[model samples]
Target: MSSPQPPPHSSPTQGAPPQLEQLFHSYGAKIYGLALRCGLAPKDAEDGVQEVFLKVQRRLGTFRGEAALSTWLYQVALNTLRDHRRRVVRQTRATEMSTLSPQAADPHFVAPGQSPVEQASVEERRQIVRLALDRLPHKFREVLILRELQGLSYRDVARILQIRQGTVESRIYRARERMAKELKKLGVEG
Candidate 1:
């Protein structure tokens, strides 16, 4: 008798084509980094990574090989981030009227004893980088994050963002220039 086969809609098995674990092992860190660059908090980034992987799992069979696998993953991650941002915006708007008035204290101030000096320095630098990133227009920051931080090729970024490769290259250049200027102001050269 022939062995039974799992249904087509079931998750791919270890012996199946296009091993999902292997794909996750190779691209997971890049996906998490991209999620972080998308302005997600650490926990939110983790959630976004999980969400992207779930998406990859569901859609892997339909991948037609027109784009690199990494490019497809990037697109999945970016869409996840966009969804997260929209949810956050909606929640913020819903809570806006009931929130208390803002205090005059610096929002970025970290309380003493909260972290060690070295940790604090790292956190401060992260804050500075995030501030610089926030200053960038969305298009520039997206390209910079995908190209520089995630280490994706310009071609992959263009494919993920649905823009021309030249546009990705130019936007990354301008984004880096703007980030450099902002970093200089923050005493974080380079």
Candidate 2:
């Protein structure tokens, strides 16, 4: 089978463009998840998603499919979030680091349909995990999030991160090792 051709640049006289909508349908969740994992709060994550697609739409017409669509989408999402992060410094909670507001402690995406007790337990555990993840060094945290959370292949991550595959493998190894230490410090049993 042939590779995907880039989208046409001309203004179609027809209805809404199909390619952007189709791209959103296919990659939207992954983009959102990536942004959230990158440390954007929920609202910022939402805005980042919009910004990512805007960038994606602007250039996807020329995206020659040199890489997989997912790789391109991941690259766009990562760059957009990194750029946004540099410009926006959100205020932290007024409470001490030792204290977490109940609502603030909930994970960005909570699993539904669990019993109330199960939900609370899960939320607490998620909060602990999130705390540990946040405490990790940025490079290690990123590698862990992409490899463990996103489940992207080492090669795919290397392409998106523009690093060597050997570097991806070594970094992922170091990331996991550090994450385990972080979790242990958070009182999680690993």
Candidate 3:
């Protein structure tokens, strides 16, 4: 079972409204992980953070506590990613497919606390794991990352994903097994 999260500023007597900055400060890492594993490239994930908050800023008053703030934020993030992906597809059609890559200017995905050499190794490993993760279908990938990487509970994941807990469990199991197989195919058996 998961530990209970205290409700955030549930009532007027509970305190002030949850600030956007505070939300970012508290949930930014989890949101970023969610975006990355949801199939956004690292660059798009960063941009998606801004877009997610913008939508939140616009629609916040409507939230009204029907669900946890985290659950609400996850929904917003997913929507924002979908919108961004759509825009990309449209632009690709308009521009007739430029071959230029955005990756050269994209910043590092993982933060490092060690020497450059160590950081490089860490980055390499992360890229490997991300590649394996990318090979999975989105449904399995989303469930696996939400539950495993972000440490959200089954109940939380089910609510955020709008799916049953049993589906989450089965998808997670398949995702893990598939990821392991992908890693092994790259000569990275563990």
For each candidate, the alpha-carbon lDDT, in order, equals: 0.74, 0.77, 0.73
- Give the alpha carbon lDDT tens digit for every residue of 44-161 in model 1: 6677788888888889888999988877877877988778755654665798741111211134667666667765676767778877776777888888878777777888888999
Over 4 Å off, model 1: 1-18, 89-122, 180-190
Candidate 1, residue 75: the lDDT equals 82
CA RMSD of each candidate after superposition: 8.6, 9.0, 11.1
- The true-versus-predicted C-alpha distance at residue 50 of model 1, in Å, is 2.1
Q: After superposition, how far is residue 140 of candidate 3 from its true place, in Å?
A: 1.0
Ten-residue stretch with the least lDDT total in model 1: 98-107
lDDT of 2 by residue, 104-142 (tens): 333455566787788778888877777787777777777
Ranking by lDDT: 2, 1, 3
Ranking by TM-score: 2, 1, 3
Clashes of 2: 0
TM-score of each: 0.66, 0.73, 0.65
Error of 2 at 20 (Å): 1.7
* lDDT (Cα, 0-100) at 50 in candidate 2: 88
Stretches of candidate 2 off by over 4 Å are 1-16, 85-118
